[model samples]
Target: MPYAATTGRSIAAVTLIAAAVLPLTGCHHGGGSRPGAPTRPSAAPRPPAPGDRTACTPEMLRFHARGVRHPAHRMLLTVTNYSDRPCDFAAQPYPLLRLGPGQRAVTPAIGPSDPGTVITLAPDATAYAAVTTAADGASGRGERISQFGVALAPHTAPGQVGLDSGPPVRVNPRTARVTYWQSRREAALKW
Candidate 1:
């Protein structure tokens, strides 16, 4: 018994279609429901081209601080590039923020411990750091502070400047900490 020419062609077409569709069924886009599962990662921003890169200095950036809505002791810190060119926020993986004297104000890092890939901010762009202050009850309402100090990542002359807080904040030395500078505000707070 033999098949007609059109029937043979139809079978071949079906085979080809099945082969193409089967492979795609195993593939996924954006990790649909399981965000934690591995998927094609979003493209990361390209690094600054060679010599064009500059370190973001205190003068090049305008810093701001305010309390976070949740987690009562947290503060949201942001630095916006006020310069004419793009710059990298590079250093010990986080911003140097001090709210009190000596070692007492040191905000323990909650993210990368060492300097990693620098987060580049184009002119007018901004970066963020989430600072979790010490618990109030633990410190019996830690030192009341209305301002905090901010320093540039890499050592820069006039390394630090004091930025005013919208309201005085209390921080205890025991548990206060800060996250590494993140490209997004939500990312800074996520930690």
Candidate 2:
């Protein structure tokens, strides 16, 4: 009975030592534990913010110009939406004529102050505008410029001038994807 008791105590001691040592064997501090080991939780992955959307493109542009009997020029511009979604847009006037060495281009001295106009375009829809330029009574005849320059209001940003025209310019809204078509021949403007 005495020998059996001693054997039992020895077994218990071995079991206790093993319990303590086994955990330590597998326990690595992940890195060298000199001082102040970093205990910060691993950074959680985050999703992109709402402002990370792609920009819109101008699908179509057209211009028409006409010379009137009273020394005035009239221009009509059409912009088409080629994207799957609707787009809001505005216009910026760009002079089409380059003044020659002796020639001068006349623009209205007191014209409309507003340069931007907002329009919505449904997928495949077109927006049009009419611009009139009055001549300043001067001397010789000058060459008439035909082309009118303008750009898409949104260009590719979100804001007051952003393109929110329809359903937020989504991708492939229905059957056809958004696309654009411009006039093949350039229209002339008489001076």
Candidate 3:
């Protein structure tokens, strides 16, 4: 019958159209446990790149100094990972001591430890460095350290920070020292 033939043609045309359009809509089979379950958009975070990640830039790292402790004479310099992806930092970070606002940069007499290893910082994780100064205030000793500035690398420009936000850490010109960067806060805090 002509009517039956027309219905067959219509069914064939619709099948062809669906076959062409389904793939365009990103429809795929077997995405779920079931053989034909529909797959929804994934809410998972993007996977981190395999192997070693990139070095931390100034933007990715945030500087934090938890209140200074007396007697111990050591300040924990926390570098928080603000980035979504894991990043690397050198084993030792050289500190550029600023005595006052707009004062000449004073490099610590002691440099970072040698054979620097790469430190991986996960998102929201922190790396720490121990800043040791004379238990007696480095103040009135001619060089009064007010702020600490750190760079991404030994050769990079110093990252800017506010010296007045927290208690100012004074470093004795002759005795100030900074430990190599450490993954664990406890390890870096050790004298």
In candidate 1, the residue pairs with backbone N, CA or C atoms under 3 Å apart (3 or more residues apart, or in different chains) clash, namely none
Query: After best superposition, candidate 2 residue 118: deviation in angstroms?
Result: 3.5
Worst 10 residues of 2 by lDDT: 170-179
**Per-residue lDDT of 49-165 in model 2, one digit per residue for the tens?**
543332234343332333333323333335556666654542322212212223223222122322333344566776443334323432223433333223333233211122212
Q: TM-score of the candidate numbered 3?
A: 0.57
Error (Å) of candidate 1 at residue 5 is 99
Off by over 4 Å in 2: 1-56, 60-72, 90-117, 136-141, 153-191
Compute each candidate's TM-score over C-alphas.
0.62, 0.32, 0.57
Q: What are the per-model numbers of colliding residue pairs? A: 0, 4, 0
lDDT tens per residue, model 3, 1-191 = 69999999999999999987676565445332433755566789667658645777779888876436643666667788898888776433544544344445454533434226666788998887776765455544434444556666655667665443566655554556666667887767664
Lowest summed lDDT across 10 adjacent residues in model 3 is found at 26-35
Off by over 4 Å in 1: 1-52, 102-105, 112-116, 135-139, 154-166
**Which is the leading candidate under TM-score?**
1
lDDT of each: 0.71, 0.36, 0.63
Off by over 4 Å in 3: 1-49, 91-117, 135-143, 163-166
